[model samples]
Target: MIYTEENIEAFNEQARLKFPENKKFFDRLKNKKIKKLDEAFHPVHEEVFDEVDCLKCGNCCKTTSPIFTDIDIDRIAKHLRIRPAQLVKEHLHLDSDHDYVLNVTPCTFLGSDNYCSIYDVRPKACREYPHTDRKNIAGILPLTLENTKVCPAVFEIVEQLKKAGLGNKGGIVE
Candidate 1:
């Protein structure tokens, strides 16, 4: 199903309910003898994104901040014709993790139409938001779990993984 703002609230609510089960599944996998969980996710990730378009729902940008690296700050500052320090002063703050994150949500560079004003120079983290299809998937399962509620594609990917019996015996469940 298409996930637009009108339906995303309900979708996220459902995701919230599933968090426990999802967490359990990942935790179990963490303790298991699984191999190539990340590789297993590749096709499912592609399939999910094929149907779920980010342009239709920029909830990630609206609800969460991406980690901006030093390079990201420099590039974005240059793009805006501002000094890096000034950009940091205006738009960023160090989070609890000591990473530079946007000071506000619904990101300042996000357009009304859900396009990024700094798409070309967006943060490395922004470019890799949701990070599902990346290699070494097992290492980032925790991060993936957090992203499920934020990105519809991530939510669907987890559901698909569960259905595939990810936590089942014999490597991956499926």
Candidate 2:
């Protein structure tokens, strides 16, 4: 992956949040690729990983809106002390693809520093922002791929994978 040491470590730390099924994809890769990924999966080198912080790179928060489930709407609305419909009317739009998404660019809920204004009640998608670590990799591989440019971590990880000979998995771009 192309991630700097810092973001790669952050992605490793958060990898557990991904769906377990996402792991199955590894089974089909060349062992060299798997070994490299395994190495990458190891706990981040403290200094290398810690040096890069999301505060410095809020690309993900600034560029994309997480898909909001109904439960997410209810939770975020209750947290904001507004009706879900009202929240939707004021801030969200039902995406034509059948998902709920924020209506504005940079996200209306994103703070200036790219912190989520609704951190505690951010949507499930936000909570699981990079689906790369997902268990359902088969289903979400496309989503993860789509999110690459918007997430430096995913970008780095895929770049690393390509270097490890997993380019067949679509980890590298032309």
Candidate 3:
């Protein structure tokens, strides 16, 4: 079944409700993705993708932190019309990677309509949400896996591959 942004959102919510029971499955997929990032490339990206509506599934925007560079900070702060320190105080924190990132869940910066509060000057990572995209596709599998849990399209694509006997076979699709 093709996953539209709407259904994907519904499923993500369902997954959360069932999170306790499905934790292992999600872990398995996450681990499998790490171990076989290379194999995941074709299977994940072969699916027809959809434009992201942050309002529908703000999981990525809200739950996880994205790596933020100095330029990202400056741009976002400029958009917000406050000092960089103020923006950092309001929306971000220093991660283990030593990068500034969103500090809260459901993203403090995500609007009720799913629009990023700092869209034009948002962090680089927000601009490149599903890294498993067309340009430089071959170089993004690892990054994509890291985001697969929060992205239903990637999750469903990989799920379909395993069910269709494609994961282990690693066969070419003419």
Q: Candidate 2, which segments miss by more than 4 Å at Cα?
A: 1-51, 167-174
- The TM-score measured for candidate 1 stands at 0.95
Which candidate's TM-score is highest? 1
Query: Which runs in model 3 stand beyond 4 Å of their true positions?
Result: 1-47, 51-54, 134-140, 160-167
RMSD, one per candidate, in order = 1.4, 8.9, 5.2
On the 0 to 100 scale, the lDDT of residue 126 in model 3 is: 77
Compute the lDDT of residue 131 as modeled in candidate 3. 66
Q: What is the TM-score of each candidate against the true structure?
A: 0.95, 0.67, 0.66
Superior by lDDT: candidate 1 or candidate 3? 1
- Report the lDDT tens digits of candidate 2 across residue range 144-164: 655554666665555455454
For candidate 1, write residues 51-79 as lDDT tens digits. 98798889999999999899999999999
Collision pairs in model 1? 165-173
Where's the lowest-lDDT run of ten residues in candidate 1? 165-174
> On a 0 to 1 TM-score scale, where does candidate 3 land against the true structure?
0.66
Please, what is the whole-model Cα lDDT of each candidate in the order they appear? 0.87, 0.61, 0.61
Angstrom error of the Cα, residue 83, model 1: value is: 0.3
